[model samples]
Target: MAIIKLSETKLQELKEVCKSFNNDKGELINVLHKAQSIFGYLPAEVQEVIAKELNVSVAHVYGVVTFYSFFTMTPKGEHPISVCLGTACYVRGAEKVLEEFRRILKIQVGQTTPDGKFSLSCLRCVGACGLAPVVMVGEKVYGRVSPDGVKDIVAEYRN
Candidate 1:
């Protein structure tokens, strides 16, 4: 994946975001979130920039990014897919749906397709418990999905 370099304007904006927080330690996650929002993902250079601005160590920033499930070190696809694997969904065969996605896309969980069109991820739950076996593409929610439904769902975006 290509690294997204932060522009001066972006860096300045990040500084403003950083200022809204009280301290570096407390603001790590928020800063990273803002960085991800701007750059799509948290690259090493962006970490370095954040470290300099926040007066934190690059290692600390890297550590936080790696430790958090919400952080990504690589670019995400144009359309990101997250399958719910909570107990309710899992019991309803969400795992099977995830397996189907891997079979069709040839990429495991937490990976993006080489073409950069799709990325797959897993979530503990979407809080839509009534909608077990849910697959979310971007902001849209898809419920009651089956293993066979993966292909159609993927193809819908392609078309």
Candidate 2:
């Protein structure tokens, strides 16, 4: 992983976010969410800054960040693609759909395309079991996705 340098402006914004929460250690999760929003992802440098501001240990902050699935240390692509691997989706062929995405994008799960247009990931459930084998591109949900349809889905955002 490459080291990230936070700009003074961004660093100030993060400090402001912490201050907004009164730098309360109890609001660590909320602080992390705001920090991630500011930085796109919680890199180690950002984590360190957050730790100092919240008066918490760096290890504690890192533990919280890693423990939550919603938080990502790496940056996500402009279009983050997520596959549902819950019991219903998996039984309905979610794995095949995920493979199709990897084949088409030429990137594995938790990887972003070279062009930074898309990134792939998997989640246990999307709560859309009725529409098994689901895929999500950013905020739009595509239910009942098939391996064959993966190409069209990728093409839809190519332009």
Candidate 3:
């Protein structure tokens, strides 16, 4: 898991987001989202806080975070790179592209760089099979990628 550094303002914001639910029982998931929004992923401390405020069990809250795809307990990189591994993308060489990213980044999927520059991950499909072998860096999408193109593609964001 990546370590999360939170500012006092952000911590207050998390509490505020949790408070908006107005109901301790129904606000669990909502608070989780707010926490994730502020921190990118929920750290253990955030989960503990939410559990204490909502009167929920820490195990229960942790379970929810672990079960949901949207929740990430680990800290993500500055730019999260998600590669598509859908059948179309796979046939188009998405695996090779992922390998290239791993090699260059020197980190496995779901990991952030020591410098906190990028995090690499994979998905089934970005729903853009026509652009098989697609990769998304944050909101921007790169399609029809090749293994050789990984470095250049990632480089565009470094600057």
Candidate 4:
């Protein structure tokens, strides 16, 4: 695949992050965290630059990025929706709730809407068993979410 070119300014900004960490190879995780914060996601081009700066193989950088669930290659929408799928949530009907979200948004899990307003994902748990079948939008949690409540929840963020 061809490299996705970033603006000159973004490259400079990324360089500054590397410089801040003193380009220490051992600081790869820290650098990646900062880089992800700046770029929203760690795309291939960003990973390439990071590898070159830290003197590591691109494969190594890619490996670390993929190993960490927190890092993402694709950009998430403004309102990222995460549904809990842990045992408690599943037993509480998270699957139906998840399906409802997919239906209303017209995008399956791991996809963002075309308008970039919402992205859908499922996590093993959010540690809220009492609030089972929960949905989190950004940092806000909506507890006890039913399949019927999916439409209103999605509409809450619609512009």
* Candidate models: Cα lDDT each: 0.88, 0.94, 0.88, 0.92
Q: Looking at model 1, how many pairs of residues clash?
A: 0
How many residue pairs clash (N, CA or C atoms closer than 3 angstroms) in each of the candidate models, in the order given? 0, 0, 0, 0
TM-scores of all predicted structures: 0.86, 0.84, 0.90, 0.85
**lDDT, candidate 1, 100-151, per-residue tens:** 9999989989899999989999999989979899999999999999998899
**Which 10 consecutive positions of candidate 3 have the poorest summed lDDT?**
1-10
- Model 3: per-residue lDDT, tens digit, 1-159? 454566889888877877787638577888898888888888888898788778888999999999998899778888999999999999989999999999999999988889888999999988999998899999999999999999998898786
Candidate whose TM-score is highest: 3
What's model 2's lDDT at 66? Answer: 99
Model 3 lDDT, residue 155, Cα: 91
- Model 4 ranges off by over 4 Å: 1-13
Task: Give lDDT: candidate 3, residue 13.
Answer: 85
Best by lDDT: 2
Ranking by TM-score: 3, 1, 4, 2
Tens-place lDDT digits, model 2, residues 14-106: 999999999999999999999898877899999999999999999999999999988989888889999999999999999999999999999
Q: List candidate 3 segments past 4 Å from native.
A: 1-5
| Model 4 weakest lDDT span, ten residues long | 1-10
lDDT, candidate 1, residue 6?
70
